[model samples]
Target: MTGRFGRCRRIAAALLTAVACQSAPPARAATPPDTTARASGVVTWAASADRMGEGTAGQGYRLVVHTSTGGSDLRVRFTNAFGDRPLTLDGVHAGLRARGAALRPGSNRPLTFGGARTVTVPAGAVAWSDPLPGRVPAGIDLVISLHTPDAAGPATGHWMAMQTSYTAQGEHTAEESDANWTRTTGSWWYVDSVTVRPARPASGAVVALGDSLTDGWQSTTDLNRRWPDYLARRLTASGGAVRGVANAGVSGNRILADGAGQAALRRLDRDVLSQPGVRTVFLFEGVNDLKAHSGVTAADLVTGYREIARRAHAAGKCVVAATVGPFKGWPEWDPAGEAVRQEVNRFLRGSPDFDAVTDFDHVLRSPYDPERLLPFFDGGDHIHPNDKGMQAMADAVGLDSLDCAR
Candidate 1:
């Protein structure tokens, strides 16, 4: 009787132990999951292309571009958008400019397309290089080298680069010294966009989409004196989230017609919408369209402005319109064009369609003429602004207006 009683007690204890084991919670993971990954990219530099020029069969181009924001995973885009045939690049490289055509030792790194050494871009297409590992800083010249073994037809490139770049014969893309890169050119070829992954995830960029004035036509070359450049400096110094500035201006580019390049309306997707992390579109065009005397009316220009605003807003971006600056002294200026300009400026100033407006007309117009550029700011053509005018235009921008989400 004593043994049986002991067995029963053991069984009851075993049942309770099993119940406790089954009800216990599972152990938590030792490592916590990453919750702070950011996907936004900032465009450190850019130039807009209008047409394709002559293409050299066995040549290399050493392009120099200044960056506006610092970040890691540098990337570059080469475009053949205006070409009529396939353009093949055998090799491409990127590096920090130690000086004029010379690169910082150990900084010249080869860039690949999908891990391949060569890439051929089809007509009307663009290619992006795989992200390069390392950090690229702000306000420094970044040099890119490209070797085109076979290129022809319409060569897409940006005319009036302002900054000087190097060129040479054969495959000299691997060279760091300026030895083989003797020839110089003021135009940027194939390459159009440079982007970087910002340190902060939510950081964004602003694109200045306009014409010659925005293109820094007469501003001191290689000094980065464009209004957008000034704006970039301000954003960086202020430690704001919107630090990237892309200059998407073509000299003589218009808003309604496809003259200098494609019109602002036609190239909107490629130039503005497709850019990575663009938060605002600063529309400062129309002077060219109005002054061209192309039979464009004030109503037509206004309609174009509204279309731009609508497209940008649809893409979840802010649209900031700028009133057309005075151009009374320009050779193309006439009473009809001036009237149209005044009407367009008035609409921009009061339009609710735009998220915000900057009165460029007020800032650039002379107090005396009211329809002519300020003498102190004019670049002598009486149309485009000089360095001082560019600075003033940039200063007129309210930084707060640029830091907005849709």
Candidate 2:
């Protein structure tokens, strides 16, 4: 079933005009607000956005993302950063995913934009929905359905979700049953960040900025087994100050180059810095830069890391740097790449530029062969970690390191 679904695709339109019209201001008037100027609250769940592909008309998307810290006054944000034309959402609904396309009975609810049921997001912009007065619990599946009557051009979204989402034709936003949703997709479309007013002002969020590993590749599909997912669970269990976790990882992404998605530095402001209640920028990247053999030297990678820390600090956020892990058995592994990894790891461990450091290299590398991942921890590919290793990496992190006052 998974394999067949993987081959399937859903051509969908961007969010546009629909029922209960809530007309937005002219495209020029609508823009992504400065979240920093507003009151702070944790972003309970978020996925970075990218240009996925083209959109289809009359297409509906039901994206499911897992939440970490839960609170009331839940809100969602829709993005059109990669769209060439204004994208409009006609129907938008939120609910708990009971299973497949089904929502928990009575859990489904309609969401409006600025007191209206419709919103038109300008090209390369985003809009946040007005808060819904409901209690959204933690560690539950939040399903968001979107209907786009006139979506076209470049469709902006996260491509490697790792979790399965449902799709259908027309407006299935208000439905609680799975009957209308017939197609399945692994990408999260349009919607990016989901925030909630925290129970306490001290509770903030940590956004993990990395590549496929942080994006949960090799982890079980539909299961929250990403290292960030593990970290989120740990933070919640500890009842710490940084309880919210948002993953800003993109598969095949690099720290300095653009290919699979925008480079980490390029998308930093949109994916991490602008997020509400973000207190820490968890920096765990560079593996791709080294492996790609793109003339990126250890010095070059170090410069990238420093720039990330500098920008994050300017945003009043703490930076936690993670040592690059070993990937000896992977095809990209070579003496030059290994040396580069070592140098970068050394800088991460000793850099005062970072607020804190987590030696993920020491956590995931094999003691006997420091150049390779521990056999049990290797997710068969030698580059990505297994579920157990993900847990170990999370366990190795110092919860206190993330609770920085910024």
Clash-forming residue pairs, model 1: 52-155
**Candidate 2 clash pair list:** 12-56, 13-56, 14-151, 15-88, 15-89, 16-88, 16-89, 22-117
The lDDT of each candidate is: 0.84, 0.85
Per-residue lDDT of model 1, residues 1-406, tens digit only: 9995564445334433433443322222211122112223788888886676778899899999999888888888888889889778766888877678987655666776665667777788788876776677777789999998878788988988889999999989878899999999999999888999999888888999999999999899988899999989888898888889999998889999998989999988888877888989999999888875679999999999999999999999999999999988788999989999998988898999988899999999999999999999999988889999999999999988997756
Q: How does residue 353 of candidate 1 score in lDDT? A: 94
The lDDT of model 2 is 0.85
All predictions: root-mean-square deviation over Cα?
Answer: 17.1, 7.0
* Cα lDDT tens digits for candidate 2, 161-242: 9999989988888888899998999999998999998888778999999999899998888999999999999998998889
| Model 2 residue 216 distance off true place after TM-score fit, in angstroms | 0.3
Task: Give candidate 2 misplaced runs (Cα > 4 Å).
Answer: 1-40
